[model samples]
Target: MASVCINEALTDDELRSVLSKLEEERDKEMFGLVCKRWLRLQSTERKRLAARAGPHMLQKMASRFSRLLELDLSQSVSRSFYPGVTDSDLSVVADGFKSLRVLLLQNCKGISDRGLVSIGRGLPSLQSLDISYCRKLTDKGLSAVAEGCQDLRSLHMSGCRFVTDGVLKALSKNCANLEELVLQGCSNITDHGLADLVSGCRRIQHLDLNKCNNVGDDGISKVSQACSYSLKKLKLLDCYKVGDQSILSLAKFCKNLETLIIGGCRDISNDSVISLAIACRNSLKNLRMDWCLNISDSSLSHIFSECRNLEGLDVGCCEEITDAAFQGLGSMETKLPLKFLKISNCPKITVTGLGLLLGKCDSLEYIDVRSCLHVTKLACDEAGLQFPECCKVNFTGSLNEPDLL
Candidate 1:
């Protein structure tokens, strides 16, 4: 490849094409500073903007990037954190970018229904909206979004505490094209709300209901019935009431299911897990059963044998898993070698058993065996030494050092 000169003169379209390929923020800024033409082209070409310096900065940038299509005003709690964007800024952003398609306002805690109303009325072309962790948002704010952005395909409202069944009803009626929804930690939502949402939004494929404690087996069963054919990725982390019955229902209908995370669903047993693995065997790729105490080696045996395309497996904190559990993976033949495995807190998994498992997984890249007392730091180091330098072995929880025996 020949080195390209930054000073090379190109048409506006050519500049836009070259600038779009630059992924790094610094590179984009440098490209803008290349020349007057480059600067103008870069400013007009920018469609996606993520600003953490609050809404005022975003407002200033909006003037220059008139073609802005996606805007992210999300906040973080890091050391560099500053005052968050408010309704005033959101209104400004909405006024500036009428063609905006995606907006991520996660953790902008100061926003209320008034700002959302403005956003809904202003950004009518919005297709994807992520307001997750914005605790101040209520049903009123959400209703405003549903009414304004009826063409929305993806919505992430996780950690919005005040949201309830009313919001789901509003979304179901308005956002019929909705394909992906993430309501993780929205404890106020129950079976009725979930059932209502799924019933209306039959196109929903990706759903994240993590920590939604109020939703039980009935709610999940309703989801399985309504969006089973379209649903592909489902996460139910710490959903205390969800158990084997929900899995069984999903297995029967969700034939195209690919990724499932039921971490902390302690009520899940071997039979239900095995049945699910068998049902979605061809499509299932990632399975995480962390803290599902009832599952043991038996479930792993069935999963490894049936789920041939399994690429990632996490059985962390599954106390019932012993050295015998890995025997299944070691014996099975897989087209795609398991790349990532997490067996953290599995006390019964010894160094010998882990080594055997590692030997079988030719493409294994990362393995976390933290808190496994039988697997010492020395063993982990030795395991890493055997594999190509690219592989990483984690044995952090154990304190025992190597002894010169």
Candidate 2:
């Protein structure tokens, strides 16, 4: 693409808006070469260009793009493109972007707490920060965010191994309006820290504790106990330590629960599933229990009986379930409000059994029956005859899946 030449008379605000959309570093560099007028405007527009383009191009306009509001250096454009953004990059980032609100430095292995603290010192308007996969980030970096970023609402710190109970305590005390929190793959937080935090952050709505293997029933129970009324969205994916007891507590307390995703939790039994269905029957809109080994057809029926407003359901790889689940589903004439349904890799589902759901469930827009050997093309053809709203379908290694898209 040719360089976009701008009129010299255009105001500064107009120039900034045009420059913000440029995704490539080469485009910004070529803009200067296009004309003398453009060359002079490049100095003021450099920050907009540098923040959007990968950190590799930050050096080209390091001194200029100092007042950037949003900095997303999650991935280097190319191996040769990102020019090793070290601790030096932090100083330029802090000095330039005084109004920086959203900063995403994901997968930037070289960045540490020192660079992050510089951000806290520089930007008081920082609200949303994501430092996922930055293993070197310790309690110091988290403390800086809690103390410095007074308006912080969303914080994602997945795999920051050094973040401990102290960081949680600081966040609970300092960041009172915190609404969304993602602490996936972090092992440092314990029950004591989490218990204190849930009691403090009464406004927490969305929480993801995926793969935080260190958290046991004590921590999950504490969260369920403290934030049951406030918590609307919760994701406990791959939380191995979670069990029936913790789930039971959540089902009883969380009244306005909209979404509950608990995939790969091996300890969750049929009793927990029954309790969740029975307790949150009216409020539950979406429930995903993929790979929960102990769950069976009985719990699936429990969901059908209770959760009337379910929109999305994923019961993938629940091997113990047979045709009885679908039979129970087809027996009723009630059109499920489900938009997304996935029962992939269930060997027990035969052609007749699986066909019942596709035919009976009319509101389904997306379906996934991947790796079910017994399902045949004729069966799918017959099922698709009744429901035509399905826009997307998946058949991962299934022998006969004619309805699949």
- Compare the candidates by lDDT and give the number of the best one: 1
lDDT of 1 by residue, 88-114 (tens): 888888888877999988777778888
Cα lDDT, model 2, residue 284: 84
Which RMSD does model 1 reach against the true structure?
A: 5.7
lDDT of 2 at 286: 83
lDDT of 2: 0.75
lDDT of 2 by residue, 23-67 (tens): 788887776776665666676554333244434456555545545
lDDT over C-alpha atoms for residue 352 of model 1: 73
User: What TM-score does candidate 1 reach?
Assistant: 0.86
**What count of clashes does model 1 give?**
0
The residue ranges of model 2 lying beyond 4 angstroms of the native Cα positions read 1-67, 77-84, 331-333, 378-389, 397-405
